[model samples]
Target: MASSSYFEDSSNELTCAICLQLFEEPVTLCCGHSFCSSCLENYWESREESTACLCPNCREVFPQKPKLQKNVILARLVEQMKLREGEGSHSVGGQAEGKDGEGDVTVNRMVNVGGHESHCEVCNEEAAMRCVPYETVCCERHMKPPKHKGHNLVEPEMKVEDPGCTEHGNSIHFYCKDDESLVSLLCKAEHQDHEVVPVEVAVAEFKGILAAKYPPLVESIKQVGSQIQQVHQEVRDTQVSGREKEERLEGERREMYRAVDEKVNHMKRWLSERQSVKLSHLEHQRANLQQEMDSLCEEESTLKASLKELEAVSFLEGYKDLLCRLESRSHFSTTEPAPPRLLDFPVEEQNVDSLIQINDNLLKEIQNGRTPSLDPNSAHRRIKISRDLRMATRTETDNPYPDHPDRFDRYPQVLSSESFSSGRHYWEVDVRSRGRWLIGICLNSMGRKGRGKECMLGGNPESWCLQKCENKYYTVHNNRGTLLSVPGDPERFGFLLDCEEGELTCLEDSRVLHVFRGNFMDPVKPAIGVYGDDGDSVRFCHLFMISFIPFCS
Candidate 1:
């Protein structure tokens, strides 16, 4: 209260008579009365071309346009008074009545301020307080004017502007439910048909509803969190159980390997012992047969000796000796036990050996394989077919062959003259260089003239190929390639086509590379392509039918 009184007393001292507000850049005249520097300057400038300056407040004239030395002490006092007035406004209040005098309410409401002080819109001086209803700041003197009458003089620090109605320029007191907005008193009158309530009543009802629902929302959040924790625990439990199962599986796998090894060893030992016994029995039989043969030879020699003697006395003597000897031999043979019967192994064992022999024959057949010659009519221009038509090589220059409908136009590829519609055919190719190459088969009706996918080997449904490009191996069919895990790069490749079985297999150095299975409804010709200009060449080695004899030695 005392602070307010003190500011009121000092307000007159701080005010500039010309501006009727706090001094801004106050300057003193020779008369010792001060006024705003701009006001004094303007007063002098408005004079009739005078070489003198007059103090607007004191009405005193100067000999010349007095150098307006700023009144530093008066400026300081004005600033101090403005700050005090701002502080006093915060603690003051006024009672005002709403329409129909429903009740008296304090007009002043405290609010926060911005960092810098606001200037009065009327006097252009440091503002003492903000008029909330007017949406402007005013000096202490302007606060008393009828223009700002009944308005709340809040602290100059107040940063938020009152939510006033834009069109009516009135304080919003009621909320229009239809518009869902706070409206001024005049706006409420305009919305008289709309459902409206005081802002305070709306706030109270909303708070009650929010307070009731907030607890359930919080409870639902807790329940969800608990379920999430339970899910995480279950996941951890499953991981532990899986680990345990894997460990047990590993242990069982080891045990199975051990048991297999032991069983194999036992079988090996049993077979070895059985083989030895059979061999021993066969050896004994061989010895007995030899003895029998020797005995026969001796008997024939004795008979010849007897015939040579032929004399009465000699014949009789030899005959008795021969008869005695023969009788002795016969007696010895009869006394000896009979040889054991020769027996073969079980049929299962025989089948195992037979399978091995069949595989061996198949390998031998592959070694003596046959090959097809490259067809000149189907060869690309960039591919030079050998004179014998057995090899196709990529060249920088095109071949001098006449254009044919069956020839390839874009890629350096060639098809074999011979095409197979049925029966299994196996062929080999020599791709001995470190160059890009393809070895596969294609339908005889496949496209041969375009530079598109239909003309490219392995790019159409009519073709399937195993290709080596950039030192990697792939089996491509219908434009899709599958990478192959080859043991090593092989110079020679073998392709076996079983039309009856609908299977085509590719092998390198006797190792199976890949196999493709599909319907061979039409005849397919052997295809070979060398990519690049001069680094690649492929030779058609030979083709032969693979004779598969099952379970035969």
Candidate 2:
């Protein structure tokens, strides 16, 4: 049976024999002493390994046959103590009193055996178990000691084997949230200016914040993408709509153009029809008027022939009566009948007197007609008739009608020699003074009286009038008294007369002359002045005036 000492020594059982404390890597020495493995190994190596077993408590030497054993019973008891102590319960160390026949003797023997057997608190029986030797074994009553002598052993809030600060040899307890700085409790005292929090609390706060904001950020990005898609769709719709409208407007414009083209063609057709009708009407009127003119000409010729015949018959009747009277007088006288004396002489004398009388009457009639027709006052009547005829015929022909009807059949007095000769010619003249002067040359019917009266200036019927025969000439007198003339028509003999000075001189048709006013003979420059029956008055003068002087002069 175990002695009561065994139960009483349970309080000190946790302490190793060599270390004098709870076992850390516990082992049994060869001398049956329980100690920490490191401490027993150190003590054994310190000896010389002599054949001896030394007792650490008693200092007794024994035989050299020492053995080492793992303290399995002690290790099992330590594991049970740690389990009970982890639940925040205190462990007891005293053994239970013997119940049945077994007393303290059994307990003491069990403790001394030092093998793989543990005493159960309830059963009081030896139990087979296996244990690791390094664990500390404590008596159930003394597991969580109330007052540790040297160490303040408290329940570990965190595991002791986890990594910690090597420099401080302490647990890392504080975290720097800004820099994720892992700091020990000791470092917090030095780095007090930094914001430090417990590591567990900071981790929890950061996770909560991230969880709260994540949903809204994702939703905002999705909404922005949706709006962009909507804008793209709207732009496509507007472009399609604009294209449709453009096509519609183009169709309408084409229709409008077609309508306008049809209207223009219609107007052109109407205009062409109207022009054709007007042309036909004009042709009909022209044909009718030409027929009427032809009939009038024929009637006038017939009337003249009838009047000549009537006059001849009257003359014959009168001559017959006179002849009978002469016969009767001769018969009554009886004495003159003897000689019929040269009857042919009286008849001839009578015939000559009658012809003279008829000539005188005809001349008187012609003179009366000439006075009125040649006078300038009758110009208005002639001009009216010419203007009417020209206005009627201008659209139908290229030839211009006469302006004055009375001038149509008359010849011009002042005529160009080129017109009379109907050929090309030229003349030149020189001026005598150093100032502006008017020089003109006129061709008439060998006299000055009819110089402009019968002249036809322009060939067109309406323009051939006496008033149109007027020509103005200007010359600068440079005191070079040589007057040069060139003939416009060379075949006809002609003369130049200075009307104001009343001087006339003959010129060979082909000759050119230059002289002062008084020096007709032996001219300084030879020239010829030509005249003709056509109506131009200054034909020769105009052709030659510029050859003798500068245009400005």
TM-score to true structure, per model? 0.36, 0.23
**TM-score (C-alpha, index-matched) for candidate 2:** 0.23
**What is the RMSD, in Å, between candidate 2 and the native fold over all Cα?**
45.3
Clash count, one per candidate = 5, 40
lDDT tens per residue, model 1, 1-553 = 2233334335656666544458899987777777788866665665564876555433445677667799998887777677755655524223222222453333322222453446554344677877554445567876653331135667787666667888888867677778898887777778878876556545655666798999999999999999999999999999997897777667655654664466556557767777787678778778887888898888979878888885898798668879888887676643335533334445655465555565566557556645688899988888888888998888898879897899888888999998988876677788786889888999998998877999999999999999898889999999999999876777677787888888888876546778898777589999999995584688976433222222222
TM-score of 1: 0.36
> What lDDT score belongs to each candidate, Candidate 1 first?
0.71, 0.39
Candidate 2's displacement at residue 459, Å, is: 89
Candidate 1 wrongly placed segments (more than 4 Å) = 1-270, 273-369, 542-553
Encode model 2's per-residue lDDT on 1-553: one tens digit a residue. Answer: 4333333334356666444556766666544556676766665565565666555433446676355656787776556555544653332433333323564332322321244444433334443321112122234433443322222322222122435666787766567756567777777776677766555445555665897898998999999989999999999999997887677557655654564466556556765666676667667767766776686576556545555655777756565655564465445421212222222333434464455464345334333321101112112211211221111001111233335433222332222222111111223222222222222222222222223432332222111111111121212122112233433423222233332333333334223232213322221111111122212122222221112111110
lDDT of candidate model 1 versus the reference = 0.71
